[model samples]
Target: MSRFVDIRIDPAIVRRAARGDARAHEIIYRAFSAPVYSIGLRFTRVPAHAEDLTQETFVEVMRSIGSFRGEAPLGSWIRRIAISKALMLLRSAWQSRGQQLDEGWEDFTPQRGQDGNAAPDATIDLDSALAQLPPVGRTVVWLHDVEGFTHREIAALMGKTESFSKSQLSRAYQRLRPMLQVDEEELADSKTTAGTVLGSC
Candidate 1:
């Protein structure tokens, strides 16, 4: 008979990690790496930058562990760190490329349907849609949709007014709408062609 190992939740693990116990550090690192990595990827399109952000996130988490008072789950704490680090990396990259922070996307209002749902024919290849967005737009969409942050919260996180954050999100949707529509049409055409070929045979 095979034996099942029982896993336990221990506050001591966190404490030990804060105290620099290598084994405890490993345990914490493994537990939160995926969530951090996924969050980082949402912020950065490049794989190498995302991976580096993930590692840097963990380092920050480890360094701050001693100050954690257990107000929120460790996973959430780590995620916050990851988001902050990814944004920092993005800002640095933007500065290096000599891009101005003020993009005029705010003037572009998204066309919303009557029921307030995305258009039925609209489809977006998630990665491509996101990649085409400006940094502020991409961050707003990812933070709101993927990470489940409210516009108000996102505003606070990004150090922008709520109106600005809302604008950013709206512009992101507007920019993506056309691309999504095109994707849907292509998919429909492909499906129709495939069906016709099958029926003729």
Candidate 2:
């Protein structure tokens, strides 16, 4: 799961939610919505899909609350559901489109404003950079880097060998390297410009 979620919920709240308490349901929704939506967007890069995933994830959470065994942290379990939902949509996309990799992410690269700071197109965010890779590669990177899923786990999720996960991650990094280099150079330029301005002042 992303660091954006703080997963520490009172177990009593789970009990209440399981008992069909509306307030408890709302509590769980508020706590988990951001991370769920974030995961959706990171995976699909589409606002509508992310919104739908968020809604669907909550519905699943409510329906399954009774069986949640507390063997894992609530957040971890919720994240698993969100990832599964996102993958299902992606799988459908793959089947429909013949695994067409979205090149739209190419529209976004590192751009800077005149103020020597990140411009409207600033591309330092991993999500933006990640858009450069193929869908499976993107999924592998996000799950590993942000969500902390091991390669073996990711491979199982994708129904591939562990080496396939490793290879995708490797390929993703390769594709992202030049963009990251540009980002680094831009940061260096920004700092140098700032220093020059300060010295003149």
Query: Which candidate number would show the highest TM-score if scored against the true structure?
Result: 2
Residue 131 displacement in candidate 1 (angstroms):
2.1
Root-mean-square deviation (CA) per prediction: 11.0, 8.2
Model 2 lDDT tens row, 81-149: 999898888878877865443322344344445764544442445445566566777787777765667
Each model's lDDT: 0.66, 0.71
lDDT tens digits, residues 1-201, model 1? 000012233689999999999999999887777666766666776777778988998888889999988786666677778878887787677778776444735444444457775455445344545555777787877676555577888877766788987887766665775655554344234233222322122
TM-scores of all candidate predictions against the true structure? 0.73, 0.76
lDDT of 2: 0.71
Model 2: how far is 72 from its true place, Å? Answer: 1.9
Give the RMSD in angstroms, all C-alphas superposed, for model 2. Answer: 8.2
- As a whole number from 0 to 100, the lDDT of residue 92 in candidate 2 is 83
How many clashes in each structure? 0, 0
Clashing pairs in 1: none
